[model samples]
Target: MAFPFFGDDKSTIARLLSTLPQTGRIEWIGQRPVRREPLVAVLEAELKTDSHMLGDHARPKAGGKRQVTLIQHESLTAVSSFLGLDAPLDPGRLRRNLAVSGLNLLALKNRQIRIGEEVILDITGECHPCSRMEEVLGPGGYNAMRGQGGLTAHIAQGGIIRVGDVVRVLESATA
Candidate 1:
C-alpha cells in the first residue's frame, strides 16, 4: 500500500492540491520465486524467531514488530535488505513480495484488501517508511517513500498470498 506522499515525490505538490484521496491500486504484485519458502518459513515458523530483514548486513533494517519489512521505500529495501544489496524500491522489482501499480493506499481506510487469495487485511493506519530505510537505502530513502502514503493493518486473516491473485477492495467491512 504505497500512496505517494505529499511534498515528497514528483507528485507531492499535485497530491496536496488534489482533494482525491490517494487510493492505492495493486499493480503488479511479485513474490520471490526462490526465497518465498524461506520467507514464509521465517514468518510462520518463528517460535518468536525475530529476524531483521536486512541486506548483506543486519544494521539497517525494515522496522517491524516481528519481521522488519519495508513497504513504501523506492529502494525496495525489504527486498534488497533481504538480498543483501542496496537498490531502489521501484514497481519493477523482481522479487518484491507484492508489486503494486495503481490505487492510492490511503483510500483504503476503514477498508479490507484481499491480497491474493488468502491474506485479508483491515487497513487501520498508514505505513510510514522508517529510518532504517534511509540507513539501508542511503540518506533520503525514507523521505522518498514517506510522502507516498503507505498502509498499515493487522492480518485479519492469513493464508497463501501468491502472485497473480486478484487483489480486490471489499467495498465495506464485514460485521
Candidate 2:
C-alpha cells in the first residue's frame, strides 16, 4: 500500500528519502561468540555474503533478513536517561553488532547502505528488545528499549568492516 503522501508524487518523497547527505561512523563493534553470552567488543569483523558475521555465533540461513544488527549511538544516551542513569549505556550491553553515530538508522529501513570500503547491507527491519533487556538493564528496561531497539539487516555484499568506518545510504528501497 502506498502512503497518501507518496501517491502521485512518489518520486518527490523518494528523492527526499534518498537524499541523505550526512554519513554515520561506526562507534563500536561487538560480536556474540556464544548464545546468551555478552557480546565482545571487536575492532573489526568480516561480513560474509548471505551469512552471519564471521566469528559471531549466529548462523542465519542464506538470504536471512537478520544477518547483522545495528544500533544508534545516540539511543544509548536516551535509554540511559529514560532509566535515570547519569551516563549512557554501553553499546555491548544492548547486544547489537554495531553502534553507529550521526545518522538515523530508522531512516535506512528497507534501504541499502555501504559501510567502509567494502561491506554493503540491506536494512531489513527493526530489531526489537528481548526479555533479556530486563536482565541486562533491570526493571523497565524492555519498555525503555521499545523504540530504540535498533535495526536488523542482511549482508548484500560482503567484506571487512571496521571501527570508524563510514556508513552511507546507497539508495532508497524503491530504487
lDDT (CA) per prediction: 0.44, 0.93
1-175 per-residue lDDT for model 2 (tens digits): 6765555687878777777888999999999999989999999999999899998999999989999999999999999999999999999999999999999999998889899999999999999999999999999999999999999999999999999999998854622
Q: For candidate 1, give the lDDT.
A: 0.44
What is the per-residue lDDT of model 1 for residues 132-171, given as tens digits with 9 covering 90 to 100? 5565447655665554535545456655544344556765
Model 1 error, position 59 (Å): 20
Weakest lDDT window of 10 consecutive positions for candidate 1: 40-49
To one decimal, what is the Cα RMSD in angstroms of model 2 from the true structure?
Answer: 3.7
Off by over 4 Å in 2: 1-9, 172-175
Candidate 2 lDDT (Cα, whole model)? 0.93
Supply every candidate's count of residue pairs whose N, Cα or C atoms clash at under 3 angstroms. 26, 0
Q: Pick the candidate with the highest TM-score.
A: 2
Runs in model 1 deviating more than 4 A are 1-97
